[model samples]
Target: MTLIRLAIIALCMVFTAGPYAEESANLTDGGISVSDKNFPWQLVVDRGKILGCVYDNKFYSLGAILILESLPRKCELASDRNGIWEQLTEAELLLWQESIEEQQATKQEANYIGNDPINDEEARLIRYLRSAKKRADTQ
Candidate 1:
């Protein structure tokens, strides 16, 4: 019994001190599951990253926060002033950053956007990216 208790204690210590401690409780390879115990809806994540929010069985995998504000939906303001972002290690943030970059690059290559186009924004973005690339090359 004492040996079993010691083993359990060691496992707990490892979880608190080892790599798993650095990860969010909801952060995993497939998706991040976030749902209030009382709420009917849940946050939808893909590939261990939160691209955007989900709504009422619909998933928005784009990294566009604009949709969150523009879409017509019943929304409520947060009551507390506490910051929303969880404190993550720089490495963890970098992982998600690279994922977002890859997704964005794919979208740019395809020249297609999920929502309606706005005033030749895609062309403008392409021009901007070319200019940025030129500047980087010159530098």
Candidate 2:
């Protein structure tokens, strides 16, 4: 009788513990929850390379296609239409874009030479001219 009671208790424990163990395993396997803040953006993988955008709020994947369509002819010409199917999340995309912008700005800054050797007035004028040139170049 005692052995039978022990067996029943063990069975009950296994049944109760099964779900909890499965839930934890699912979480570890990257099963995203809707309420999770990290779920806002995700990379849409296709063939291999990243090709387009996907806004979290959009129901369809047409956001990237529309963006590509809206680009200027010259910009469109530079895009690889065939391989451009993958998408990185907005945050990841922005981070990469910002880095590229920073690199371009740094390269531009490195190309300039100061004409004002000693005079404070000339130095101020040079700084002003450089700032104005940078603004114009960016636009």
Candidate 3:
């Protein structure tokens, strides 16, 4: 019960607190909302399709798809919010998209700084594995 209220409040905050809130409208299709007029870029939210709160002006996912997909090796809500997605204003959506791009750029920069082939965790694991292999060969 309390959780339901909290979710509702959160969704309301997404809609009401922003400058473009008044212009936003719930889409006729339901569970989806869009902001078209007050802002230049249209922001769309399809609760049935996406899990993450951020939208890339392209596709919707739990987080930035590029960031989430870069893993080197491998591998929620209440009633009113159960299938409801949070809609961001044009400014907010642009900011989110920019941040994701920034992160991706930063990651790429790190990869090329010294021709470094591995991250800290990967380097640590490699070191351990090499040490283990050396010990086994000696035995």
Put down candidate 1 lDDT per residue, 1-139, tens digits, no spaces.
9567444434433333222223333223222235435433334333454444444333323221111232211112223421122332354334344444555565455454555444567667877988899999999
- Residue-level lDDT of model 3, residues 38-129, one tens digit each, is 53223333455333333223332222112222210000222443322434445444444454455555555544445656677776676688
**Best-to-worst ranking by TM-score:** 3, 1, 2
Evaluated at residue 105, the lDDT of candidate 1 is 64
Expressed as tens digits, the lDDT of each residue in 6-103 for candidate 2 is 44433433333332332423211222333456543355334553233223322222122212222211011115432222343454344334444555
lDDT of each: 0.39, 0.37, 0.38
List the candidates' TM-scores in order. Answer: 0.23, 0.23, 0.26
**C-alpha-based local distance difference test score of model 2:** 0.37
Candidate 1 lDDT for residue 36: 38
In model 3, which range of ten residues has the least summed lDDT? 66-75
Higher-TM-score candidate of 1 and 3: 3
**Candidate 1 segments whose C-alpha is farther than 4 A from its true place:** 1-85, 112-139
The 10-residue segment with the lowest total lDDT in model 2 = 69-78
Which portions of model 2 show Cα errors greater than 4 Å?
Answer: 1-84, 114-139
